[model samples]
Target: MDVCLLYFEDCPNWKVTDRRLVAIAAEHPEVVVRRKRVETMEQAERVGFRGSPTVLVDGADLFASPDSAAGFSCRVYRTADGLEGAPTLEQLRVALGLTQEVTR
Candidate 1:
């Protein structure tokens, strides 16, 4: 699977997503992870960037909502706990189709 993490320089939440992706990659060797820095509104629009730390699996947004619009801003995720700066590790696992039996 090709996983691309789209982020900007200012958003700290991207790091959280990156770390979770790293952990997932460690367990799933087939997963290839990459990062893209969206620096401008034009770039964001051209790339369909919903927000910082957007995860794209196989070139599709993993958690995109119909209402999401491209912009250079922080992205909030709706996790089990509540609104969060980034998705939880469990969320990432589920999105990536990782089995629960696998642990870091």
Candidate 2:
């Protein structure tokens, strides 16, 4: 699985996202992670870079929002606790399918 993390240099939240991705990759060794910095508006528009820290799971947004405007901006995630700049570690694990199924 190839994962691309689209980000901008100015956003601090992108670092958090990068760490979370590495943590998740530890469990899924098959996953290859790559980072792309959205430097200019033209680059953002050309590659459809939505914002800083946009995780693309097999070329699709892991957060699942295709309706979002394409630009260099910050992204907010609706997590279990509340809105956060980045997805939780657990959320990332689930997305990578590295979690075991346990009955509640």
Candidate 3:
């Protein structure tokens, strides 16, 4: 599985997401994680960037919201606890279908 993290330079949450992705990588050896920087408006439009820190699983936004518009800005996630800059760890695991036991 290929997981891509899309974010802009100003986004603060991308690093957090990257850290989580690193953890996930350790757990899921078969998955490859990549980071894409959306710099310009045209690039964002071209890539369908919903916002910074958008998690794309095989080029599809995993936590996409119908109300959110595509742009180059910080994205807020409606997590289980509340509004957060990035999705929670559990949320990501669930989205990626990695809820099963992490191989030791």
- Between the candidate structures 1 and 3, which one is better when assessed by TM-score? 1
User: Relative to the true structure, how large is the alpha-carbon lDDT of every model?
Assistant: 0.89, 0.81, 0.85
Q: For model 2, how does the per-residue alpha-carbon lDDT over 1-104 read when each residue is reduced to its tens digit?
A: 98888999999989999998997778678988999999898988776687887888888776757688788778888786788988777777667676753222
Q: Candidate 2 has what TM-score?
A: 0.86
Q: In candidate 2, which residue ranges exceed 4 Å CA deviation?
A: 100-104
Superior by TM-score: candidate 2 or candidate 3? 3
In order of listing, the candidates' clash counts read 0, 0, 0
RMSD of each: 3.1, 2.5, 3.8
Native-to-model Cα distance after best TM-score fit, residue 27 in candidate 1, in Å: 0.5
Q: Which numbered prediction scores highest in lDDT against the true structure?
A: 1
Please report, as a residue range, the 10-residue window in candidate 3 with the lowest summed lDDT: 95-104
User: In model 3, which regions exceed 4 Å deviation?
Assistant: 100-104
Evaluated at residue 14, the lDDT of candidate 1 is: 98
Q: Rank order by lDDT, top first?
A: 1, 3, 2
Q: RMSD of candidate 3 to the true fold?
A: 3.8
**Residue pairs with backbone overlap in model 1:** none
Model 2 deviation from native, Cα RMSD in Å: 2.5
